[model samples]
Target: MNHFTICASKNDTHDIEEGILDTLAQGFVVEKNDSSYLLKSKGLFKRHQGAIHVIADNTDPDYFAKNMPGMMSFYHNIPFEDEQLKELVMIQISVFNTVIAVEMDKEITDEQMQLLIKLLSSIGGVGFLPDGTLLDQQGLVIVYPNGESGPSNFRPHACTKMINVQEATSAQGEARKNNTIAFLVEKGIPYVASLPQLPSVEDCAFKRQEDIAKRAVALLIAIQFACDVAQSGNIEDSREFFLNMLHKYNVQQFLTDNEKSFLQAQYPDAQYPDAQEAVSIAWQYEAYWTLIWALGFVETLEFPDDVCDCDYAIQVVSSCETFEQFYAQIAMRSKEEILDEADKIYRLHWACVNSRINGQAAPLALNESVVMERRRALFWMIGYRNEQWDTMSMDT
Candidate 1:
């Protein structure tokens, strides 16, 4: 049963909600039997008990505003407050338009027009609930204007994706489009798209921008660590340095401030709370930051010309079991290149993160003394300090 459920069919509830969470939350990449990466959210696609009663499209500007109150009441068993439900609706509306909406050529209703707005805003993070699959091609349900019956979404490739929004009496077309967008917006949930370099992950342009932000946050945290320690004159463990900086500068706070300025200066159409939530998650994702850095996944930190051998991967980075193994992937470059990377804390900071998150530098986990000694060997392969790290751009 869902940990939060009180349903009598407790087994059914568990089979639904947890199944979705277990599959989609946090991790995005899943290795296939073929050793390839599946960037799709497999969990959302998993078979489950929860049901989404796809409702009819509505056109009233008040359609979503109206029905949401009903859904809010109906899904009481789902345990979301009205405001939270409203926020989800807003996020969904802002992400994709009339998700799973069908195309109908009819007089455009206020609702259909409203739906077009949502579809245009939909990006990588939008998807159907429970099994977050594609709602529709480009994740939209097209409602064409009346007297234009078979246009099929009005877009270039929507021909194959076309489906009539609702069967109208050559008359009720407008009502249907509004109802459709409003319906999907009400029921649809926010979905964070899976990882990169996979067909399942759409909106490559947006994802690229997001990945840049994630990497920059990681580097910023590391730099803050060194800068903080240098200022206070402490040479303790990098863990202490990390905590101190988090406390002193409150990384989350600064990120919120910067993000606000960014949104205001650029992305005039973008929403705020959503942007804030994303950065907030990245702020605490120290492990990911470290992983991207050591593995050279973040382009900004990549050595100018194979300067650091961190490019090779023996196994999927996420599955690696040892910190030393992660360190070994990136052998040091020349003396100048090595210094280009940064100082002792630079190496030490990552080492500690790898060890703490995956037990890389620790001896206790190995049990075998030889294995422990071997880890110590790999840990030191990439020398201390890398000035090269500081040169990367963080403009995203």
Candidate 2:
């Protein structure tokens, strides 16, 4: 008996077998005696003369891709999506998978990669998801992070995260407005110049780079921490925190009426709801600015003085191909075993940035599996054993 691998466009078992037959009928013979590639189709595949094994991705892809190391065959189909310069686009289409990418030994710069993805999207070769991945019309993510499903029914769309804390500070609001445009200017992404300033607190939301979704889990923690601090911290703490953070981020020009009134009040006697809202707002003001600045900084590839050393981070992330490998090494360690939460988060940030820095163009993120796993583990580690922060509420 021998095993074979089917590389199908679809993610179904029956379709894969039929695809194998079709491919075989087309006179494309399997070079490797032990393995084969099949596109997906419906109906049972005619049994071969001898016993053979077949496997697929979705469940089987990751397992075989990793475990069946010695029996590996790389298949990459380059979809021609960018038609900007017809001939220029063809030049890129010739380089499909990593093996070819590596074989060509051609290094594309980060700027070039960004432009290429945009070009591909224009040509219908890819779609940009709010999740920050590039998908084809068939819903297969052309460029995705590590350990994720490539095909889906859901179409991609531009994503914007609205920071709608009613008590938000001026800095938070402007981060939604000014800094976003600033970032566009910084990154050279074209946008209309006279864009209106964001109106509602909800308007403070902006689109993010796809790789930043690792924060999907961490966001719950931040929200909870804000809620807790809001409930427990004194008015002085809230007022002082917001005031300090707003000034530090220099967003005082954009302060909200509520935030302004609260800071100006002589004897800050805000009610419970108002107080909590204030704390949450203040935290968001600072947090959003910091996040925006950090993300923008990463685009420059120059580590901010406030951030860790890039050389050290590059050294740390060099070994990780996927976030899976990176997590396997760190997940076992207790909170004390590693650096603080900031360090861990930053390391993940670096891991996400690794491919982009290496000229891989589209920065893929950590898979949802790893993101959810980290979320669960961090919840327990943070001692949030209570049901309050369980899956349901946190997910919202």
- TM-score for candidate 1: 0.18
lDDT per residue as tens, model 2, 256-336: 354455454655355444555545443432233222223332222222223323243333323544434433443232222
What are the per-residue Cα lDDT tens digits for candidate 1 across 294-392?
444444442111122322321333244333343445532333222223222222222223333433443222222222212221222231111122121
Q: How close is candidate 2 to the true structure, as a TM-score?
A: 0.22
Clashing pairs in 2: 15-40, 15-41, 57-61, 145-365
Q: Compute the lDDT of residue 320 as modeled in candidate 1.
A: 40
**Clash count in backbone of candidate 2:** 4
Q: How far out, in Å, is residue 163 in model 2?
A: 26
CA lDDT, candidate 2, residue 5: 17
